[model samples]
Target: MATFTTAFPRGFAIEVLDVYSGPPRIAFKFRHWGYMEGPFKGHPPHGQRVELFGVCIFHVDEDMKVDKSEYFYERGNFLAGFLSCPVMRGN
Candidate 1:
């Protein structure tokens, strides 16, 4: 989380598109938007805009406390976007 905060100093935003609840689990489909302003995953600051879709699932116990969470997103798309930045052209 801290890396994200530093990487996208402009801030990141998530828009929930859909949500589903089943017993003790809740799932969400969302879109994320941000700009790369700092190094990320060893890539230098590129100052490029990034938008991606992802899904997250949260599991809660009987006490209503979240015990686990998982996130899924397209790595290819994300890496492609990062590599597309003009600043990454030489490398």
Candidate 2:
């Protein structure tokens, strides 16, 4: 896991309504954060072993309402970089 600082300047909680994978917009339902953390090992076309820096999912409703989101940042802006980090990404 990629260790990162926990001090994010702009703290927010979000809910991801969907994530678009591949060519078509394949509608997906709520996926638990626990299920997404990866020490995921596979050959990605990007051609490198990249550990997931945690997940940051943002969801906005049809009425433009923010549901919930979380930013488990690895390399992030400002404050978090300065503060201590608790969690990390899997390798």
Q: Taking the tens digit of each residue's C-alpha lDDT, what string does model 2 give over 21-90?
A: 4222223334222222222223112212222234454555666555765455445432232222233222
Q: Rate the local accuracy (lDDT) of all candidates.
A: 0.84, 0.32
Position 6, candidate 1: lDDT: 86
Candidate 1 per-residue C-alpha lDDT over 18-54 given as tens digits, one digit per residue, 9 for 90 to 100? 9977648989998888998988767787787888899
Candidate 1 residue 55 Cα shift, in angstroms, is: 1.4
Candidate 2: C-alpha RMSD to true structure equals 14.2
Question: Which 10-residue window in model 1 sums to the lowest lDDT?
Answer: 82-91
Colliding residue pairs in candidate 2: 1-89, 1-91, 2-89, 6-85, 7-80, 13-69, 14-68, 14-69, 15-68, 15-69
Off by over 4 Å in 1: 1-3, 41-44
Superpose all Cα atoms of candidate 1 onto the true structure and report the RMSD in Å to 1 decimal: 2.5
